[model samples]
Target: MAATHDVTNQVPDLVGHDVAHDPALLESLHRHGAGWAEAELRELGVHAGSAKAQERGRLANENPPNLHTHDRVGHRIDEVEFHPSWHELMEVAVSRGLHAAPWRDERPGAHLARASKLHVWGQVEAGHTCPISMTYAAVPALRHSPELAATYESLLASTRYDPGLGVPAGKSGLIAGMSMTEKQGGSDVRANTTEATPTDSGGHVLVGHKWFTSAPMSDMFLTLAQAPGGLSCFLVPRVLPDGNRNPIRLQRLKNKLGNRSNASAEIEYDGALGWLVGDEGRGVRTIIEMVNNTRLDCVIGAASGMRAGAVRAVHHARHRAAFGSALVDQPLMRNVLADLVVESDAATTIAMRLAAAADRVDDPQEQALRRLGLAVTKYWVCKRGPAHAAEAVECLGGNGYVEDSGMPRVYREAPLLGIWEGSGNVAALDVLRAMAKQPDSVEALFTEIAPVEGADSRLDRAVSEVKKELADFTDAEYRARRVVERMALVLQGAGLVRHGHEAVADAFCASRLEGDGGLAFGTLPVGTDTESIIERARARF
Candidate 1:
């Protein structure tokens, strides 16, 4: 008799379900009071979570973008060609108004709704998000110059997603890019060598090279150049009004570790025509609006990674059997999965809370929360993403190491968030800066934590410890990481208590706040209600 190969009980890939139907995400949206937009979010989640979306994500990454510097006739076209999957992803996001909904819709939960949409799409494909993020962030900064806003605001906020390269006057929609850092100064814009000369038309012409130009295919860019007054912000277009290409020449594309579907370029400007967005010397102040908005996205992106990782791991474990039982049923595996649930929940809750704060325009407390709390959450949440993804990978054992399993891509995407907008040290320094320069921000942090002041003793103690650290000014800069860590832990702990499941909240406070867990993921205290946590957070598909 021929020996037969057995193929029984192998777990299938997780797909064909709406991410909006995710119990954790839905609970988070409603718990954070964003249910009003649930119908729209649910539709987006269905598309993003579909098998087609998953295949598109894979196709886009598998076929990275190609740069075509010139036309067949040797004319300088400077175009970047992307796979159809990339365009499909962008169309899905843009048609849903993910790029401009918050600024365009003057509703109570506009930001919350928009954030949910972006978070869901990030899980599907993150590379297409770069330009979308820049376009959404450019609004506030452009408003600094009413002329610039009047010229571009409506175009930027249009629901149509135009990939055409030309002057904005002819486009149905628009996207923006940012070029701030130079080789000499990675994060220090003040050290840039790019120069901008005043033009007769009240604008300026820029001549400089940007070391890292994100989404180089964008129709417009918000960049900084050294003007006569000082470093200033400028709006550089890909094509001038005459339908001719600008002097922006593509240097080459950066070979990034991840985000391969997105094109990041190094380019030189040869008298590139640009318009000033604000006062000549106030470039940093104006551009900071864009930076802050992107920072918020960085935070949400990390949270989405955490959620995807956890859900994928839990789904695999539920179907894969070991020792004559499901891996998820085992005691130690249960602890690991549940711990991930807690971490994922904490990340999502805080992100949505920040979005809620963003929508409350008249609330000074929300403004303070935006100023200080955003940095803290960005630092901690983004910093946690890699470890969280690694833990989820380990739960899948050998399968997770392979590319088809999807865990590897998730892991690669994790570090970009913490590094983008600002590195870990930069985020920590900003947290300290907010505390010193804006005392009200510190007060806002306390106000957010007050709801759970007495609910959990562990949370209370963590808050007290953070307060003491804040009070002591000795070597604060040197201890910024530690200070910021405590602040993050306190905020996450309190946030869980207020908005998360009791078992999940208890596990988080016990493991994260009281230090019951070891120095890594899956080290939750032994007595955690692992099954309940997993059931709530496991991927339904």
Candidate 2:
């Protein structure tokens, strides 16, 4: 037989499969992009022409944008653009987006929220963050009409679009979404004291104050309130479909921690007529579909921040020399840089897969798989990215602490990722919930894995541990941890799906999920944090 064991047959096609979807590996779509940014920007008319225009347009980098200067804070905040080609257009939009009508200097605008969290988060970082939040929270509920859904997606698909096309071309030329937060309520959604009642005029009256309404200037909001059958989600508009005042109101701007370019508002509404979304009692569940997508946004932003910081820190380490040679020359620095590069690359892969799943999954079991995958991947990447970025900053010594270096911005951003959407704990709980609902999905998930050759061995060990854990539902917390831990395995299986390496969903069952060491984005804690910590300590410490 000529002892012919061809290397090609024996060795798997590497590029044929995108290993990036490994649980810890973030999807590669974003990493593979940057070229698409300008196209996307220009497509939305975000930047009209010239690279200099794009680089120069970021007003937040210098002047920073603001949102608190308007009387009617919620209906439609102004929009601003810093890219020179569209600077004038950006300024007007920014002003309108922030409700700062009639263009103004960026100083005062940023001042209200400069150092606060809102400023950091307000500006659009990744194109997907703002659009996703709006699409899920406001747009779906906007027209609730198929016409509107298509309109919403079209506008968002490309950031730089003519406000004239699709819904963006609304004569008023405005964009917005509903943001729901009250001063008193956190998880106790039922405690929302905001009242929406039926009026004699065949319309509902909205009365109450919302503590934190993101994108306050939104044209429409799927406002939630205390209605007849408990909490209800109602679609309220700035301008009714007829372009009349829908009675939407804005209290003031929130001036949050980060995301400065975007406005966070507090609003009060009186008689804001809105249609019920879904059924009356199903408000929480109905809106959850929207929130779930936003949660995914939080993950993308957090992961992107990690990548930005990593790239910068690594670039510096590679280029800037100290102590006889470049920082890249030092063993410790080399290790740190390598770790960052790998983590960033991996996080990108799985994040994209998570995004893909969120958009596509239809099966109830597959849906549950999607849910667990997003929850665990998000929790893991957000938590680990920060630690990695902060350490990368430490590698910068002192410059990273300063604002100019940009590492501080990203490091600061890392915390919000975990805190927003849902905490790691909440996501872990969701993982458990999903796992119980779809046990087979859980079993099928852990069946695939492939990594850096020898790496398969570790996945085998981890997966065996997962199978043993999933086999028993005796402990709720243990189940939760197992649910999240399987993120690694799900990621690997998903990689197969991404690469077309497998035809059936579980075709890659023969391989184990592989990853580099250090648990960047898939560590699952058993039970609640308090109990889990004590349990782990007793086991090893």
Candidate 3:
């Protein structure tokens, strides 16, 4: 043989694995009362994480949505065309009730179950989750007015996914989008200049520009505009009842860093016929419900990305050899992989627990927890995603940086979650606002974590510090990030201690609560059981 090369140490394929049946995911689901749906979840997971699904994800990203502004005859026809793979993914998502399953079922663990499904599918392709999340979140806000709810609830709740554009009454199933940001008012809707002039038919006509309108293919959008009464929420349909295009015109699609499979656009409304959904001038109050649900999905999407990263990193390390040993067997690599595992688990734990609280809508305590817990979890988990993806990419070394490896795509997708629903500062300020306005939220969070009070001394100290920090409201907005991070840490500590493995919990409390960690991933204390933690996280795959 002239020159023999060895390929024996190459990592085995990670595709075709059942994401929902993964031990870590299963553990989290069971802990959060969603285990009852394990059988169905496992089937979905197998397909979602399968090699075929991977190919679909790749093709979808490789070919982004194309905007069509006019017809062949020069007629104004605003439409977006996506690759077939995008439609395939949407079909799977909608047929499974991944969009509005909780609202449709109204069972004990409906929201938790829907959250689990979203987590599983998101790992396969996160871009499609945007429209799914929007449709899911729109249900509650649509209910703000019985008339609006009665018109769209059943269509939204339907498992059918129809991508066609026409009159809403002609469609069997529907998707919803949102446009709240304007050129001047980024997040402050009060600064919006979109004029909502009352029409003779008791409807409103919107005339203004929306800087960001995601999922332009949606049949309707929940948008904010300045009504004569003040800032108000409106249901702006893409097509009028006459089956003609509404005055909503697509300006252009955004050139985003990621989420290419979904179309995010800039549009203008010139006399776009709309109906008020809630009390005029109460736009923020009405749309806040939708924003909250989407925020929870952000947490889920971030955690799902973390889980995917951890799985790929650990799986690669387990089989790939270097310097006469598998990478996973090396002490330094083990520490890094284990730390990623802890981060993923903590994120998953908090997201699932919040979902469970959302499911328990009948309970007052759970309601309070949902109010505060959403902001806290969304801020910490989403903020940590980009960092986590970076570390996971490093674990695969040069191979991870390539687009074909899928790591770069995930890395790009990470920041969108932080930006969407709400940015980090926005979430942090929301947490503070919740505390100042609804003190009961804080007490509910305390009650939620009280079960693990003495489970770990470090956790106890962390809890005490957070309570002390909350006592002084001076410059609270400036200190909001620190306060929210601490709340997230304590919540994770308690959750891990109660539901996660002791080794994992101890590592989290030691590194996060006790301040033993550095400013990066893989900074867990040397004495931590790195091997056991990595093995547990990897065993799921």
Candidate 4:
């Protein structure tokens, strides 16, 4: 999170999915991906000739563009900035961190190294660090990179970094916002004490130290500050200009619990320059869009952790030995293995569905649902999924804890989700708030997925009973834990379906056809496997 340190390596491009093609995806995002249930943003009047807008547009494409290359070398400086005449660059970094490969890669060094650096150094970053903050930077670039749609998401995990930083083209253009918890905030946002004051220099100055800034050393920051009107956000930059030259200060980084790769920081601004995001007191809502991204990302990151862990467990289980038998051969172990498979699939499905929904969610109300779904998913997976890894560890006995085994690493990264972002309590409140705002629509959402989660079946009859309990409850607060638990199961099931292995929805439908095997295809009216499995299970019963 410092400035003036030497950076020698070029970040690696993300390793999966080609994001530059597929116009068909945008159409789908509007339907199921973004989910249009939320109210719409009334488009503001278009000013074709507004000089300020024109200047912004013109500069947005100017040379040296808006990439914050200094962050690469900003890891060692510790000076205060006081100049007031710096020019704003019309550019931002376009890299997506958690969703991108090399960073999200879960390998030995790259991801761990980057995340740890951010953890320890993020405080003085002078930029954004968390997944949610990164999405702020991606929005502008997406304006010009329409072709990057289908491929530009880390929404499942956390918009913790800029998408322009993801893959294919992640070298430049990054911007960040600091929406870490306020003092009255969860994960400690409530403890925030940053203030924005009108200065004699005519530019505002921000003075505060926040606990969690997702990315700390980028060029620009969208920061939250307290004022007479209440909480407001400001566009703060890391620059000090004396007359015509600009200089910046890199402050401090946080030592985080898990995502040792993405840098989360605690920052202090001593009269750093800032511009209000909207009107006075309007700063809080202006950046909710950023938090919404984080909510969805929490789901994605957790799900990704589940998948990575499952894959490793699956691989290890196949080769491991137990009591002179292959570990996978034991019936009890198979159940554990199946549990791993099922949960991983469920987690992935939830993230992908929400990711698709996020792409099209223009309405705040509707986005609230997507947000709740994602938070619940992330919270549950990040919280419970690690136990599955531990189960695999038990399957491996002591070897699982060995850092070299890959199991320990996944275990390490998985738990961080619950602590970072909003954490479970924060996410639960977020979902509760969403449910409270649109009780009926929220109920409808619950009803819509209940059958999917608990299909008319022999196995899920109990799950159906739980859904009924959710439906009968009128108070979101009353049903908070119950609702979250059920929704976790719902998303857990959905996550299973989005699997690279095949979906869980089909698997549930397949259960109707083939009870215990967990099939991938829907039941056919003609029923071949359905009929046979019915007979086989009937014989057992």
In angstroms, how far off is 188's CA in candidate 2? 3.4
Candidate 3: list runs displaced more than 4 Å: 1-8, 539-541
Tell me the TM-score of each prediction against the true structure. Answer: 0.98, 0.68, 0.98, 0.61
Question: For model 2, where is the 10-residue window of minimal lDDT?
Answer: 532-541
* Residue-level lDDT tens digits of model 1 in 1-541: 8769978767898887677765656676776677888999888888877899999999999999888889899988778899999888888888888888777888678888898888888999888898888998999999999988998889888888889687887899989899999999999889999999998888898998899998898889999999999999999999988898889999889999998889999999988999998999899999999999899899889989998998898898999999989999888888889888888888988888888888887999999988998999999999999999999999988899998998889988999999999999999999988988999999999999998878999988999999999999899999999999999989888888887789989998988888555887778886788888998766645
Preferred candidate (lDDT higher): 1 or 3: 3
By lDDT, highest first, what's the ranking?
Answer: 3, 1, 2, 4
What lDDT tens digits, residue by residue, belong to model 3 across residues 1-541?
7768866666677787778755556786677677788888988988987888889998999999999999999988889999999999999999999999889895578888888899999988899999999999999999999988998899998998888877897798999999999989788778999999999998998999999999999999999999988999999999998988898999999999999899999999988999998899999999999999999999999999999899889988987989998899998899899999999988988888888888888898999999999999999999999999999999999989988778998899999999997799999999988988999999999998899888789999999999999999989988899999999999888989988888889999989988656877878897999877887656344
Q: Evaluated with lDDT, which candidate comes out highest?
A: 3
lDDT of 2 by residue, 180-248 (tens): 667897555667898879767645678888876665545557768878777887767666655556555
Local distance difference test, each candidate: 0.88, 0.50, 0.90, 0.44
Q: Count the backbone clashes (under 3 Å) in each candidate.
A: 0, 68, 0, 74
- Give stretches of model 4 more than 4 Å off: 1-76, 79-133, 136-172, 177-179, 182-191, 199-203, 240-252, 362-368, 450-455, 458-479, 491-541
Q: Give candidate 1's TM-score.
A: 0.98
lDDT of 3: 0.90
